[model samples]
Target: MNSLQKGNGSVVRRVKLATIHLLALGVLSGVVVSLHAGEAISPRRLIEVVDISGPVVSPDSSQVAFRTEQASVARNTYDSVWYVQNTDGKTPPRRVGEGGVPLRSSAGLSLPAFAVWSPDGRWIYYRALMDGKVGVWRASADGSSAKPLTNDPADVRNFLLSADGKTLNYSVGATRDEVIAAEQSEYERGIHVDSSVPIGQGDLFRSGNVEGRLATQRLDVLGDGFARVPLLSGVPDRWKAIDLLTGKTRDLEASEVPSPQTIASALPKGESKPWRYALDTVNHRVALLTRVGDQGDLVQKPGVELSVLLGKNSPRHIECQAEPCVNKAISGVQWKPGSEEVVYTVSDPAEGMAQSIFRWNVKSGEVRLVARSAGLLNGGQRYGLEDPGCGLSSTALVCVAADANRPPRVEKIDLETGKRQVLFDPNASLAADISADMPVKLLRWKDAKGRLFTGQFFAARRTGDRPPPLFIAYYLCPGFLRSGYGGEWPLATFAEHGISALCINYGPFSFDAVERYNQGLSAVKSAVDLLASSGEIDRTRVGMGELSFGTEITMWTAFNSDLLAATSITGALLSRSMYLHGSLKGKEFISRAHKVWQLGSPDETPEQWKRIGLEFNLDKIRSPVLMQVPEQEYVWLLDSAVPLMLDHKADLYVFPQAPHFKFQPRQLLAANERNVDWFRFWLQDYEDPDPEKKSQYAVWREMKAHASNRGENPAGSRGD
Candidate 1:
């Protein structure tokens, strides 16, 4: 200003005046504003997560359709939609056109989801909301031209499309309330979720043919833009359509038949009882699956022949074309690609666990050995039947094979020459990617009783070294262990972090839901004793983790036993009492809830409930535990669950928003990573104690160090 020229004097004065005005404004506001954030941010900051689930491949197999929620950058919440993407995972998926997310309310929790695909794969047929109500909608493969396919008021259970894409096949209904009542009865009788009876919603409708108007309407693919068909299948809604073109939907050929007294005497008690009904297909063939006392048999009428499929002599081979060709030697059957031939697993029922694959010509009634892929007819591990859908082509079928120590391996079978090739071997993958030098052993032990129990042990690569922290996972159902859907992360993630893992199957001693509800305590005890006796598991450093109903069992052990050094219970079954009262305490198997809770409900039997709750006796658990709950964890933990644990001072973490299921890869990965770290901290401490526990100044020094590393005031920063 002092050096300003005469010609610019007015400009200088104006600039000084503007500076004074800015200072005045700042003084008036009494706050300083900056564009960038400071060092620390909120720990609760929301991150966008994707739900890439229900993968559907297009006819060309070049594109895949899936459902997920996309984030609103401003609002910070996601809306659901059907999206399409390249199958190779190369391209990012885009929405199938613009539409509002279907509102999930108390009236119905079922939202529109991917259901069927058209013949050409150019369109993804789904049940979505068109206005404010629920209905079926179809969208182009690329998320374009989304239009309604059905306008049924009742909820759509599932859907199918004709090969020509001109007809849409679907089933619709309300949840089976009666089936739920029956389930409640079992729970009341001390049956847990796993032990409860399984009743199909269709069973509720089985009283008669679906009580609905039935007729098929031709889908005009090119006209009407998009058709909105009414709800078809089941009772109450009473809207159904029977296609005249394809034999996809029609009335039953015959009523359900009662089990013969002899068959009933042979059948297993409880839910193993089977119902028989006839499916009226194009050929007027009748299909029946019935269970008697201990024996289950499947018979197709017109042929008036039967084969046992589940209980005794469970029929595996049945040619249902004209002459009824029945073979007691077969156990599992799958219709071939053309639906002409049936591939069956044939073996002697008395052999316990053995079988071979055979092909039966339905038209010719000729049975021939396709392959002797040993254990095809084996009762225990090989009970899973081969189906034509698993085949990559008309000539090859995909099969899964497993042993006690290893997970199942996928294989392809050639029908013509009976050659077999391993498609993807989990065992080989674990060895190659995890360790080659480590001694991996599959061990079996019998508890005090003579029954056998199986476990997998991964010893240190070097000789004579105690295995790193041993972890156990009850992945599969006790009854279905060999081919069960095992727990996902504990086995693979633990290996990734150089930790030894043991997968224990608590089967034979207690198999199926009824056994699970009845004998969980004994089964767990047996498994623990067997594992400890082997001396392979570091008894002092062992950690346990399980999910779904397994979480219920694991928590029971954590509460009662001091064997586990650390534990994780995801999707916990915290309360049985609430589930039965229908107060939304937890999600339950519709058919099994009624009778299952009586034995374990805290309200009914205080002592038993105390044991089951795991909260009342948290002090008994010596291990540092981590309990993660999803935002909507009604499937397991209810409103009372978290508070009960908190009252007991249990270590817990809550995912602000998450689902009951574990199909999300990222969330699962994060959980696994945290588990590995927690176990490592506890187990590694067993070998080397943290010396920093000694000095008083050590705490301050560590704090300062942390602050320096974190580049923030450790004492002041609370991550926000």
Candidate 2:
């Protein structure tokens, strides 16, 4: 049975946190602890926090629709729920449909895939996965009922609704004849070996015994050397439309479908060219938003230029009179109702990464501030009313916003007064508990290269006179500090257990891969110096955790400097073996790798390979390393991990059927708990009391003994 009550003119649905603890502990065994007032966040609690996204306003601006996703350990996957709330804050949000759409790309789940509201504001339509098939679905806004609009066999990748609400157009993947033939061949015979399929893709096919052999076979038969076809390539997406009046569906001709970018025209030529633009049909003018710097330069000064083009007249640049006018970037550009004004959002990195909404009068050329946020607006990377995570209306702006401590929540801002009202908070209780235990402080520092960088420092409560060990997670630290980008390391949990942590954002990168790695090394060293000088942490006991690009930097730091006591990476390293493995993907991938890494065949570029390759620098690394990666990436680690394992300096664990970013609840919990244990053992010389980890501690103890025999210290000491 469930219980609900009324709060603030809305129904508040509450669940017992103890139930979550029990469920998590029962599934993952020793991964979660009981939650209580003032208790610190655990690995399971962080995974269970609701991730809210796709906030879209109704056609009449009377209500907003959004989705929430949370990890379900029992199901071993994520569950998404959609809800509808009145924009006026007068009524509580209601659960609309059974679930929201599941939109995934090659990389994995893409969030903020908005649901389209019906013209009459009575029904909201979205794409969802049912019985392993993706199709369009709709639910009554009043939460009375829900049903599917399209039941196509092929997965619908995208869709659009006509203004009149009488028609809906959708696009789905169409299998090619070659693909079908290849699949049939694989079914009858084993997979055929070839260079056309990437090693990762081929391994996936072989592991699942599924149908990915066609693209590779096609390439092989055609002898299309240097030309690469994706592992799942087929004909272009086919479009279909449904007529609501007659309840009929039909294929759409190419000419009947408009281009995806019909709203914006060609970009103008200039140093500050706009990355995004919009057209005003009513006034016959255009609005462009540009960032003032080289598009590829990461450390350029923060500045933006908003210009308007009226007829054939010269472009007019709108002047911003507001203080702190330096803008890092601009997004969400659009013409207001009646084309009287243009509205856009600007993010100021200098002001704690604050975002503000501004309106520019086309006729008078006056810029006025509508609303501002000390944290993020709309979402982290993109900011726009048209964005799936935000919506705009004549009288208000609704978006998903959050800061370093708070989780994302739906907030409605009054357009006129700039007043903000919280419409819904999905993680209120969890956020409160975490915030109380671990407080964040914004940190800014410049590396030796004079490049500016920012970070979030989560301070731990000191339990003794000696400083606590510091843990560093690198790459991007935007919005909430939810264990960095991949959520691989539990930052709050670390701080609660007496390990201070810092999440550093990478600065401008160099085209030269070696120099870029050096930059990351400098940034990490600078951060350690800053915290140590302030008596906030013990720099000698510093540990690091990373994913993707951060893993590269961690390796470089380990080889180039002895600043790290222990390191954990959730990715594979780049090496000679990896280059050969990547060649299986095709010529284009190999070409891109050459350009990015400036590496060729080892026979041709021995010096280049020896300079940055992991295999060549393993002898220089003194810190112990932990490798936890997806099964797809596990093979790439063999070159380095095999050597390190023999030397008792590394450990590797792989998650089956996992993507680059692990999404399974059990896998995520295991990774998180393993990371926590690894850092504690190396940095603090502490071990968990759980008896299940007895064998795990035994292996580490042996590694520690081996390190001592080699005249090395696994744990940091006062004197080297």
User: Which prediction has the highest lDDT against the true structure?
Assistant: 2
Q: CA lDDT of each candidate?
A: 0.41, 0.68
**TM-score per candidate:** 0.51, 0.86
Candidate 1 lDDT over 577-612, as tens digits, reads 334433322333222332333343445567655644
Model 1 scores a TM of 0.51
Q: What is the RMSD of candidate 2?
A: 8.3
- The lowest-lDDT stretch of 10 consecutive residues in candidate 2 is 1-10
Can you write out model 2's per-residue Cα lDDT over 1-720, one digit (the tens) per residue?
Answer: 000000001000110100012222122212233455565577777777666677778878899988766676666756666778899987768877755334432222233456889999999998776655567888899888888888776657679888899998988764434445655577578666566443542253433211111123222212212222233444467899999788799999989974643323432344244546667655666676666766563423345666666633444555543443334367557666564677787765444455678777767767778888756777323211134225777778787887777777779988778899988766666667767777788888887767777788899888888788999987766566666666779898899888898988775555577777888899899999889999999888999987777788888899999899999987677766667865665675466566666777888888989998888889998998999987656777788999999999998888875545566678888998998999888888888999999998898888888899999876643421
Instruction: Provide backbone clash counts, one per model.
Output: 54, 1
lDDT of 2 at 40: 57
Name model 1 segments beyond 4 Å from true: 1-280, 286-332, 337-341, 344-395, 398-412, 421-443, 455-464, 477-488, 506-535, 574-594, 600-604, 610-613, 634-649, 663-665, 686-720
Deviation of model 1 at 614, angstroms: 2.6
